[model samples]
Target: MPLVRIDVIEHRRTSEQLRELADAVQDVMLETFAAPARDRYQIITEHRPGRIIAEDTGLGYTRSEDVVVVQILQQGRDEAQKRAVYRALAERLRERTGLDPQDLIVAVSANTRADWSFGEGQAQFLEGRL
Candidate 1:
């Protein structure tokens, strides 16, 4: 399972727009990472103005208030798959939500089975329930 957190500036997008953005990311996860159909976990947070700040890091590209920062926590994904997810997220978010590709920032983190407990304080992956 990949747990995703999407952060965006408050008052910039409507609730429907947020769902569309999340759906776009989910589509990318399913297509590129091959995650399970029901294994979707996403958290979308809207921060107050000036609460989120992102610099270009000298990439010569400027970001606007429409920035979207996505953090993905997953396991067993190779570099090629990660790259594909990034590209797909950018394209899909742009097409679905009108978000600028340059304003989309994605970061994927690696985790193991021991790191997750679906419920009941049980380690499902370790117990072979996953």
Candidate 2:
């Protein structure tokens, strides 16, 4: 299971656009991470202009208000798979949402199966309920 958090500047994109972006990310996860189809979990947060600060970190690229930050908390995946997911996500976002690759920042934080509880205070993955 991957819990994705998408952060973007407020008023930068319409709701439909944001939904498409989320779908694109989830598609990449499904393809490269082999996550279950029913395991879709995501949170989208919109921040005011100054509230979200993203710097290029000397990459010689400038970020605009359209910048999107995708943070995925998921079970460990191999480096190759992660790389493929990143590339796929960027490409898909560009194609589906017209977001420039430089405007998208993706991060994956590794977690264990025990870290999740689907409901009723139960760790479904650990208990074989999932």
**lDDT values, one for every candidate:** 0.93, 0.90
Off by over 4 Å in 2: none
TM-scores across all candidates? 0.98, 0.96
Model 2 vs. true fold: TM: 0.96
> Total clashing residue pairs per candidate?
0, 0
Q: Deviation in angstroms for 27 in model 1?
A: 0.6
The 10 consecutive residues of candidate 1 with the worst lDDT sum are: 53-62
Residue 121 CA displacement from its true place in model 1, Å: 0.3
lDDT of 2 by residue, 1-130 (tens): 8899999999988899889989998898898899988879999999999998889989987888999999989887988988998899889999999999999889989989888898998999899987
For the record, the alpha-carbon RMSD of candidate 2 to the native fold, in angstroms, is 0.9
lDDT of 1 at 79: 98
Which candidate ranks first by lDDT, i.e. highest?
A: 1
Distance from true position, residue 77, model 2, in Å?
Answer: 0.4
Expressed as tens digits, the lDDT of each residue in 88-125 for candidate 1 is 99999989898888899999999998999999999999
